[model samples]
Target: MSIRHGLLALLERGPMYGYQLRAAFEESTGSTWPLNIGQVYTTLGRLERDGLVRALPGGEGGQRPYAISDAGRADLGRWFTTPIGRADPPRDELSIKLTLAMSTPGVDVARVLRTQRKATMAALRRFTRLKQERAADDDLPRRLALDAMIFRAEAEVRWLDHCEAHLGRPG
Candidate 1:
């Protein structure tokens, strides 16, 4: 996830300090991705330097809030419209590990798949439960985030099954 764009998106809501941005981010995403306070301040500094956000005068609590600039609005708008490309996909560590295991002598790929399938299924169950609990709440962002995670976990399990089946077939 692009922390820069995320901060800008939150700032689009209104002026917010580093702490406020961190809290709002977690709340909006259902705490799925927690941000470090230091990371938040660092990103804010970069955003301010880039002129995507401008620092506001210290509030009553002396917190230095930031507001999105016009450029920031344009950047955020572009981010929203841009479809995430598959040209440079993120590396799947699990896939890498499985591939290495298959090539390494004495390494049991089947065992690895079984272990990962168990863990992924456990995560899927937890996500499903969370989704059910939050289903009635009027929280679209959180629901969307949870749904994405749940679906990804389900897909991973399916991929693992496919890998096992492929291994069993005569070469």
Candidate 2:
């Protein structure tokens, strides 16, 4: 989820002021993804300098709107067609936490897993509540998004259970 590229996609829809882009991105993603307006404007400026967008002068007190250029459309098309191969190193946060836990001689690994299990279960419950709230509001899209989050949280909880189960097994 590159906010820079996501902003480009929004501009491709039509010309938009920076604030509009920020709001649309947040709403479309159910407010799960956060964006900084300053960062958006900085990226928009770079896009303009790169010939991917053109900034039109503001009207009176209104903000200046930016539109995607022909070059920008082409760049977006290339991005769509290209596969995003993994170039950056992977980050396994849970593995790192577990490694530290193993190194701490007095650390209780089971206690750590139990704490994580409780947190993950709480997350799942929170997401479920969010989904129910969205359902009551009759917002299908947001409910769906919350459902995905709930499912992911439950999956992690299950994985924690498996890890705990194997903690004392023969190597």
Candidate 3:
């Protein structure tokens, strides 16, 4: 997730302190991805430096609130309109581990695949349960997040099955 864009989007609502921004972020995303307080401050500093956000004066106590600038609004607009590109896909640690297992000596690729499949299946079940609970409450953001996780877990299981078959493992 782009913390910069996320912060900017939140700032669109109004000026907010670092802690407030962190809470809003987690709340909006249903806590699927928690933000570190330090990270929030760091990103805020960078945004200020980039002129995307300006620190407001006279914050209560030591807290420094920030507001989005016009540039930030334009950038946020572009971010919303731009489609995420797949030209450079993010690295998958599981894929890297499996590739290394294939060539590593005395390493059981089948065992590794089986273990990952089991774990992924467990995660899928958890996501499904969460989805059901969220659906009951009509929590749209969390439900969407859970759906994404479920789909990814399902895909991982399918890939593991393919790997097992390719490695001559019995079904």
Candidate 4:
């Protein structure tokens, strides 16, 4: 997810300082992605330089609030309407590790898969438990975020099982 776009979306609600933007970003994403205050300010600075946001004057304790510019609104609108293309898939660390492990001598490929599967299952369980525990009171955005995580973890487990099965097959 683009922190730049995320900040702009939050600023659409109104002008907000770095701390407020960071908190709102975490809240909107169900705290799955935590942002450092420094990172937020850095991104804000970039946004300001790009004319996507403008600094408002005289915030409390020198916390300069930023309002999204018209350009920012247009950019945010494009982001919302545009389908995220997977043409250039993000590199998966697990995939990289497994590929290297298979080729590296004495790497214990089986152990690698087993360890990852165990970790993924634990994460899946935690996500499931959170879903069950908060089913009654959680807001829609948070529930959706949690659900995505649960699905991804579940998929990872299935992929690991497939990998194990492939390991036993004759070459």
Candidate 5:
């Protein structure tokens, strides 16, 4: 996830202190991605340095709020309009582990796949339950986030099954 873009998106609303930005980010993502206060501040500093944001005068109790600059607004707009390309996908740790397991002596690839499948299934169940429990009027962001996770988990399980089949395991 792009913390820089996330913070810029939040600042698009208006000026916000570091704590407020953190809380808003968590709330927007349904707490799926929690941001540390320090991380928030660090990103803000970078944004300011890049001229994407400007730190306003300190408010009461010395709370320094940040507001998005014109460049920030343009960047945020680009982010929203651009489709996320998967040309360079992030490295999946599980994929790396499975690949290593295949080449490592004494490593049980089937057992490893089975273990991951079981865990992924459990996560799918949890996401499904969350979806069911979500109220109709719940924020769309949270619902969409949960749906994305559910879909990814389902895809993972399918991939695991494929691996098993290729290994000559019984369907």
Candidate 6:
């Protein structure tokens, strides 16, 4: 998720402590992607080490404040503008497991697909409910994130249906 870059973008707004940064991040996107406080601090430390962020001297807040340097701004800009290509070697754990199942003898493919369909429907329902609940927020970023979740869930549901319909049927 390039959380380090996300933190840099937040810091660009102004100097902020880790807790404030965490809250700001969660609020801005409604945290479709969650982050632990420890992870935020870890990223902050890395940014500081990388000369992207500098700690305020003698600050005594529960979470220390950091300001973005010019280098940090440049890095944030570069990160945002960079295009992300598909990973050279895709790392899909689900695809790997399904491949093994398909190869193994005496495995009921329909049963496997039905089980996955159940799970996917549950997830789809969850996302749908969340989207309905957020319908009134009217915040662009949060709305966009919710919309993304809904779209992905719907896509998974369609794929599950397709898999179930085609299982064990050779073309």
- As for lDDT, the candidate ahead, 2 or 5, is 5
Clashing pairs in 1: none
Off by over 4 Å in 3: 169-171
Candidate 1's TM-score reads 0.94
Best by TM-score: 4
Error of 2 at 164 (Å): 0.8
Return the TM-score for candidate 4, rounded to 2 decimals: 0.97
In candidate 3, how many Å is residue 122 off? 2.0
Candidate 5, residue 69: lDDT:
99
**Runs off by more than 4 Å, candidate 4:** none
For each of the candidates, the C-alpha root-mean-square deviation to the true structure, in angstroms, is 1.4, 2.8, 2.2, 0.9, 2.2, 2.1
lDDT of 3 by residue, 34-146 (tens): 99999999999999999999999999999989999999999999999999989999999999999999999999898999889889989899888877777776678777877
After superposing candidate 1 on the true structure, give the runs of residues whose Cα lies further than 4 Å from its correct spot: 59-62
Q: lDDT value for candidate 1?
A: 0.94
lDDT of 1 by residue, 124-170 (tens): 99999999999898999899999999999999999998999999888
- Scored against the true structure, residue 134 in model 4 reaches a CA lDDT of 81
TM-score per candidate, in order? 0.94, 0.79, 0.92, 0.97, 0.92, 0.87
Q: Best-fitting candidate, measured by lDDT?
A: 4
Clashes by residue pair, model 6: none
| Model 3, global lDDT | 0.91
Query: Candidate 5 residues 1-171, lDDT tens each?
Result: 999999999999899999999999998887778899999989999999999999898576888899999999999999999999999999999989998998899999999998999899999999898888885746999999988999999999988988888887443
Error of 1 at 117 (Å): 0.7
Query: What is the C-alpha lDDT profile of model 2 across 1-171, one tens digit per residue?
Result: 667678888998898998999998888678866789998889998998999999887644678899999999999888888888789856767767877996789999888888888988988888887776677676666777777888878888888888888889977
lDDT, model 4: 0.95
Question: For candidate 5, what is the total of clashing residue pairs?
Answer: 0
TM-score-wise, the better of 3 and 6 is: 3
